[model samples]
Target chain A: MEDNKIQEVKSPSLITTPSGGWGASVHVFAPATVANVVCGFDVLGFAVNEPGDEVIMRMTGKPGITISKITGDDGRLPLDPAKNTVSVSVQHYLQSVGRADVGLDIELHKKMPIGSGLGSSSASTVAGLFAIKTLLGDEADPAKLLPFAMKGEEMACGQGHADNVAPALLGGFVLIRSYEPLDVVRLPHPAGLWCAIVFPDVDVPTREARQIIRKNIQMKDAVTQWGNIAGLVSGLFMQDIDLIGRSMKDVLVEPVRSMLIPDFYKMREMAMGMGAVSFGISGSGPSVFAFTKDEETARLITQKLQQHLTGLKIGSNTYVSTINDAGPRVLG
Target chain B: MEDNKIQEVKSPSLITTPSGGWGASVHVFAPATVANVVCGFDVLGFAVNEPGDEVIMRMTGKPGITISKITGDDGRLPLDPAKNTVSVSVQHYLQSVGRADVGLDIELHKKMPIGSGLGSSSASTVAGLFAIKTLLGDEADPAKLLPFAMKGEEMACGQGHADNVAPALLGGFVLIRSYEPLDVVRLPHPAGLWCAIVFPDVDVPTREARQIIRKNIQMKDAVTQWGNIAGLVSGLFMQDIDLIGRSMKDVLVEPVRSMLIPDFYKMREMAMGMGAVSFGISGSGPSVFAFTKDEETARLITQKLQQHLTGLKIGSNTYVSTINDAGPRVLG
Candidate 1:
């Protein structure tokens, strides 16, 4: 394989080279992220170890861009460039960078389940935009690329929230200051920290979950929420594991959202009792996640949660994951 | 100076000796602290260098407590130990530890002006409790002592607020997570940080200030406040000074409180333009505090604020200070 030539051609459009083909192809994988990590609400998120999406982009001779392949979504994803989130994101980025005429064929692998509270859509969006940027060479920075990819997430969630996308794209615990100019800062992630995420066979529409919440909250509750967030942020900085556990509490969002999850209270208590430091609904959930210091505790808590749900006769899929450091990577 | 004799003074009650008595006496100074550093609302606070109070507790004759001398407040402070905030706090701590009947004579030297937005009452309470604890050979732990002192503040503010008291008791940047169990955490204070506190001649009584706030806040505003708080916490942890400045905004409280401070908008803008990392009303203000990177900037910002007020024909007093690491110490 030539160093500059496209490798592992999976898209039909790439077979015939375009007029401006740089003979280079790009593949990007963005890790799955867990948003609203318990008390973190809108400010906290971390990338997960497994279950991510991959996107490959190649300069092509096709009249217009096309998503030739999208596996793992049961053929539900759109192939036409304009109707797809990934394609739309890429288009936005290209236009921003003055490269709108660049033609490319893209392939997306939806490895994670959609609407799973695992930042599935964000992963795909990040993966697609990242791949296109890689193929276009280093013409854009991650900060510039983020808003474009986040627009894809906005399509899924109705509003663009970067709590999940930022971490998935940047590969660490990220704080999104604002989505306007897309201000984000990455904080340190402690080593050996693993999270146990349990996705029960239940679904809660994000819109419905958000609707149950009050449009206005008492000023007192707001104060409490900010206090918890402050503690959580400080906990991460000091590396005080116990403080981190204590700080992962949400008074504003979880009470309303938890009603949608089965045995939410019991599962959270069980997790904590079984050595999980903290537990909260993952994003706008039917899924819940908990943090543990070690794999043994993670496994123990996972088993405890599974046992609690046995009466419901529903199987729970559990994943014990370390923090994903490499958010997105190229795979040829 | 006998160790056993000091041990016998189990509570503040046992330190009834006058200031000139033969028994050893301890005078502790606790600096005034700015609580709720803007976005932190109820969670963040840092101790300031200037305008601190002195508490002088000494052994005396009778086994009954008396606030022997109150030099500040223009002789308005209650001389009765039972009525004073500091003495009551000491009493509470003693009772909590099952040593409530010790006698002492306490002399409070008020260094900071009351109602100056410098946590004058909290400093007095912390200094008194701390001095008595030290004189009795008790290990002074602010975390354990804050709730007791907070009760005294409740008498003054009509509520127990740890924003100021926590930092005054425990030096550095402190977070008040909860008041029920009095959970507080001391967050890291970045190096070379200095605060310039400007006290314009005005008074916004804490009680009246509390009345002006709306009981209900729009959920949108609450979320923005929490996001900013999270950013502020992340900035402090990552030592990203720029983010810290951006996050110090308080959309909920400052807008309402700023009305009470003369020329607040102009002062804040001047401070920020002058390179203040963060600026906000210092606790139910009439006083405003701004953070800078160095002593030079601190001095420059203070002078700038003074100049701004001069232009407005509003007299203002400003003090340049570093983060007070020693919260409360023996003055002698």
Candidate 2:
């Protein structure tokens, strides 16, 4: 009966095809993101060029959801669709877009390392949900689908935050205006800008890192933070690169979070001296990222960061990326 | 002797001519500014369209400085250039630009009322310095001129702050990045937005009002303040009106300062409910300003604020303004 049902729906558009067939399957890739870009704190994020996740979604001839493949993870992720981040994210998308009857077979390629401060789990969730929506013929808007993906990320990180998922799904620089009901604003990508991301071989789980932050901040520090964020946003809009560099200060979060990253302050100083426009800890960070004006500066800064990490007896990987304008896309 | 000195210099530039001379010294107008836009605390400011201070500079052949005329100030302002805000500002500018030998007959048209929480002193200083520079063939850049003008404001307010003065001089939404050396960033001004300024006939001196503020703020509150500022700046860059409204919360300064303004909370609620994007005490005030997307809404908000003040037995003057892009312009 399942074979007969598959034969009946032979269209290229995934939206019209029935859900009970393996033929209506597709792969998706979603880029990793940098959250809390300096002064932005909890509001701003952007997608990077490398170290992304791959998600394959196939419509199983079963009655419910299942996770068929989960390579690269240390055998910890669950196989049930309701328990796994990728499968659960797909389940959420199907439910939210009113396609609850669909049964999904999801295979997550966790290319980026976990606990890398590079939004690895968020990348997987965004890739899986986005692919499933496309396989269903793009029935949901990206903005509409983001909250569901963020929910799946919350299942992993134990908090609902869109700082990473918004950029991972939409690309470029994005501002999460509101978390309740999830509103996001995407700003124009400044031309001739590139980012150098350096991930050291150290693990700092988001939950453990977050636990170290003090519950309260001084009002004076907060004012300074707001001022910096205001300057940063205005700098981006004005395309004032110098102002952007000046405003990349984090008085509230970075001062506390930097204690967890070894040689963080030294690396930041070196990157700045090497002509980086700005430098900051990525996410909760064992990783760090620096922005520059051109490819030459970005390359120089990457080498500088890697050299410093090697001196500290830590292995490192570096990539130079322009702004990612294409967020999540079909693999074809 | 004054007439003889005036006749000695034949140049048309007022900055070059002696006081009581026939040569015209062109004075400029710099718009009044709204500082600390709600949640922005000490960081945000925007130039208003109407009700600006006028600087009248005439060349005096006299070897030293003299303020020849002071009108519209109810005879309260000093005629001596050494003691006056505008004159002191001019002297500071001349010293910074290495033009100390220049003699001037300066006049300040204090059109806007003092103690209005509308940056009256900063307007006067910016206008005076700007006019003097223009008269001297634009000898000083705004960046070099701001510190001097800011000093003039500090003379009146007891502290130097660029949140108002920078925007008043440059004419747009501005972010004060730092106080030392006065770093400023200009933000985009979305067209068609207007501000409604209501000045109740009550005096709250900047010195007295500042004393009421708490010296320390909680760290949690500070974090929320930065978050709101980030949201507001992002909203302005994206032109999201609703987001702008939501981000207009002040946890640090407003609660302390609002006690000086009678019916402050009522006035804010009335204006906000009437479609004002944001409303707050302009500086340290009995005066308050509300932002709106258009002139009509601004007018409506002005009326509502006026009505609220009237209910509290306070009389007020109201003005509507668009963003002033042309700041400190010389008038021949």
Candidate 3:
């Protein structure tokens, strides 16, 4: 029956047929991202090495898309292709390329925790899209797929911003210059710069975390925020680690969002006291990240933070890695 | 009697004596600056080569400060030592160094239009400070005098911001990362960038220009503004001219301030249509500026803008130059 179905696929392009047949499969891994980057709010983000997501996609003869499996999400994610971010985003990408008739099966493996404020959904969505792109032998730039990935983000969260998906797609530090035309630029950074991310096992809903932020910020505070944003970008371009640390300050969102995570201030003090260069809440919070100059310090700070979270009787996970310079890669 | 005044002075530092006498004079030139730089608001600025001010300072045996002459200001500037920005700022520097009793005479030559929004007062104040520093053989870094220069800014305008004074004193493009501790850093830029400045003969009081701006802005707009700020800084660092042009957009202040300048939108259209890279209000702005790649284009844009202002029955002044890498220099 499956062989008979293969005959019905009308001329799947030669580029899509590696073995001159329809059962080609590809696997891809996409890095998780940290958005806002302290003072940047919705304008800045970066990719990290660990706690990412993997997607396996295979071409089928049927004229539709299906999600075969989703793991490590504790049944929190929807299995329906209509409701799932990965399948929905892949469908969007297919339609965009005039390949809506292509049939595929997707499997999302969440290597990271869900709702950790570590861009888990963005990672999954990017991974799925990357897998499909790889399977179809598409030669388009990965950044060209960003808009489709952002659609998945819009479905996962209420607002459609490129901060998370951009870094996750392009790698390194990314500055979203504008949203109207969707301008995103990759910035330079110090080679030795490292990030220490700790995801505390606290549930801070994305909607409520966003709602807690002041929509109407004071003009003076806004000036301070932009100053730091300019400084951070300058620091990155200059490759001055100390300046980057000094500029990693948030006067708008963190002050309010920090309240959602228990012992947030104490953890920050500990991180700074342990020689971390800078500290701030990641994404919408419950997860937080600190920066350091070397892998040793990054690991030490993460261990210290995880210990502090344990002292508060809260479970936590820790990861220490330099910035992920390569966004995504074919695993097999 | 003239010789008797020198004997009355208590042991002055030998560094102050250049000709083995109490009488020494120094002349200095300080360039004008463009603050806000479009999207930067209060955090970014850069120096320009033309339309600057000159200060001539002469050490005297008398035990007080005096403003001996002022020129080219249409008698709009004050000659009183206590009231004038140059003399007032010089006094602050003198008091800081515990040399308030040292006698000096200052001559301010306003080479640029007064209240042109081209940082006229900042150029004058920086010139005076530079003149004093050079005359005294003070080998300290020129940036150390920024606070003294900022005092003159506070006296000229109500607020004390480093956007103008920092670039005027430090040269090159500058970013004021924070105000509390006054962190200012110079940024690198492409060598070929040129500016076309046009100061229309009109009044747009700095205080009123500031007052007209919204005190509280929507978070979305602030995000957009900071995104552009980051993009501009990154563009400067990357030496990407088109990126810089695309990022030189102001969502907060320019909307309100443009109303003050006649035919502001039309002028912007003309400049942009004529191959200008970017255009915006230079400071609080009766003065406007556009950036171009070469000297010829800069001069042509300025000429065209002046003609447009002339069509409106308004008088104007125009200057064209590249970014000023040297902030202030000793004339003699």
Most accurate candidate by DockQ: 3
TM-score of each: 0.91, 0.89, 0.95
- lDDT to native, each model: 0.78, 0.78, 0.87
- Backbone atom clashes (below 3 Å) for every candidate: 13, 9, 0
Model 1 chain B worst lDDT window (10 residues)? B1-10
Interface RMSD of each: 1.3, 2.1, 0.6
lDDT of 1 by residue, B1-332 (tens): 01100111233333233344435678888999887798877667889888899988876655667887898789778887778898888888767766555667888899888888889999999998887667666653445567777888998799988889888987888778765545677766677788999988777898998889888998878877877887777777666677778777788999999999998898888888888898898888889999999999989998988888887787777888888877888768
Badly placed stretches (over 4 Å) of model 2 are A1-23, B1-24, B74-83, B218-220, B238-243
Query: Ranking by lDDT, best first?
Result: 3, 2, 1
Predicted complex 2: DockQ: 0.45
| Recovered native contacts, candidate 2 | 0.58
Model 3 lDDT tens row, A1-332: 00100111223242454553588898899998999999999889999988799999888999899889988889999989999989999998887777888899888899999888889999999999888877777775677778888889999988887889989988999888888777888988899999999999989988789998888989999999999999889889878877888888999999999999889899999989988989999999889999998899899988988888888899999999899989988898
Q: Report the error of model 2 at residue A158, Å.
A: 2.5
Taking all chains together, the TM-score of candidate 1 against the true structure is: 0.91
Please name the candidate that would achieve the greatest lDDT relative to the true structure.
3
For model 1 chain A, the run of ten residues with the poorest summed lDDT: A1-10
Over the stretch A1-332, how does candidate 1's per-residue lDDT look in tens digits?
01111112122222223334664677778898888777666667889877789988887654357788999888777787777888888887766666666777888989877767888888999988778766655543454566777788777778888888888887878766654445676767568688998887787887788788889889988888777777777777767777778778788899989898999998988888888888998888887888899999998887778877877887777778888977888886
State the weakest 10-residue window (summed lDDT) of model 2 chain A: A1-10
